[model samples]
Target: MPAILLLIVSGFYVGNTVLAEYVEKEAVKVPLEAYLKGHETGKPEYMQKAFHTDGKLMFIRDGNYTTIEFKDYIGRMNGQPAKDEANRKRYIESVDISGNAAVGKIVLDYPNARFVDYMSLLKIDGEWKIVNKTFNVEPKNSSD
Candidate 1:
């Protein structure tokens, strides 16, 4: 009787663990899809959907740390696809989730530069929203 109960309890736990992983991955992908759409369409609305209103973008420029609020970045969108749309690509590399928090990495390739972005997200009000992003950009043809 004791062995049978143990087996049943163990199976339940295993099933729940698998389900949790699947749920987390799918949830994390929601914001990423929105992010990709924003870049592809050059629409600020898509970016607004993917990120929290107060999200911040951080990077280093000329040996100085710089930060841009999401609002400021969205203001620069031109509402048209980039001129190099033919050469543009965005790829989601990986995502790791713990409870309601997650981190994701993606690569963006443009005609003039390549960027790898690491985003931090939180599941808020039943939806995942990007809270922060840090990225490294390499200009095309740069020797470094």
Candidate 2:
């Protein structure tokens, strides 16, 4: 009886682990994918797909807190990839999810600047979408 109980417990543990991984992946995948495509292609449709309409980008500029609404931010994109796209690097560093909400950190390294982005996301109607984004951008030097 004890052996049988142990086997059942082990099976439950394995199943739980698998389910947790699935939840985490599903929670993080869509937003990151959209974010990557939008930045790489410089398209607003991809950005709109990833973010909520009211999402805002928050950052500090010249010692003042500044915000950019999603529409304006999307407008800043010129629908053209950066000239040095070959030298750019983008990565999703980490994501943490709880129930229907999540947070993610991403890094974008370009020839001219490096950006660290923090995204707040929620699962709305069975889909995960970014509701807010805040980032820090630093001008890059020729070396390092």
Candidate 3:
């Protein structure tokens, strides 16, 4: 009975220590949120550090949709003015890891627009990078 109680207590403490709350500290979390902010801040170099060379990006606007090469995406953003990049921000909501694959959900924040998306990650060369994403923007609530 004592042994079982000890194990239960230990598990409870460990779970609390992992996720913030209930007076726990030193709990580690994924760095996806930081990277998202880095990308939004126009630090492509920092953003690139998290992506594989073959990373691909897909976006939709109006009635047209397209997938763009990562290199081209970076190149196009390189010389653009700051205002153009302001609407481009992603907030990573969660990350789940299973072996070499991870699934992440992010919320895109734009002027009068928003989206919740799921991105699949593949670990290549010991680093996790986005491989593909399936997403759709949320329809605006006219009542707001």
Candidate 4:
């Protein structure tokens, strides 16, 4: 009887752990989806919803390292989709979470270039927000 009780308790614990992890993963996707929506719609408000106020994006541009505050980046959005928006494809490739922190890999395939972005996120005040982003772009003609 004791052995059976132990087995039942163990099963419950494992089930709860798996359920919790699944919930966290789904929660992490919320911000990532918002980020993708921002790019698709050319709406800065969606970006703001995904990023923390102090977040920043870093990348190499013209052989120089460049960093832009999230606010500045959002400001650059003209609230109009690109002329070739129909051809643009954006998606979250993967997301990994540990405790209250998470990382997401995003891919943006454009007519001219492909961008791979790594975003770091933190769960603060019971909400997840992207805190930093770094990405690399490859020209469409580049050899894979």
The global C-alpha lDDT for each of the candidates, from Candidate 1 onward, is 0.92, 0.89, 0.62, 0.95
- Model 2: per-residue lDDT, tens digit, 38-128? 9999988899899998899999999999999988988888888888888999989888888888999999998888999999999898889
Report the alpha-carbon TM-score of model 4 versus the true structure: 0.93
Model 1 segments beyond 4 Å from truth? Answer: 1-5, 142-144
How do all models score by TM-score? 0.90, 0.90, 0.62, 0.93
lDDT of 2: 0.89
Candidate 1 lDDT by residue in tens digits, 1-144: 999999999999999999989988988988888898999999989999999998999999999999999999988998898877887899899999988999999999887799999999999998899999999998997443
**Preferred candidate (TM-score higher): 1 or 4:** 4
Off by over 4 Å in 3: 1-31, 59-65, 79-90, 138-144
lDDT of 3 by residue, 74-115 (tens): 565453335746555566677666666777787877655677
Q: Which of candidates 2 and 4 is the stronger one according to TM-score?
A: 4
Q: What tens-digit string does per-residue lDDT give for candidate 4 at 1-144?
A: 999999999999999999999999999999999999999889999999999999999999999999999999999999888899998999899999988999999999998899999999999999999999999999987443
Error of 4 at 11 (Å): 1.3
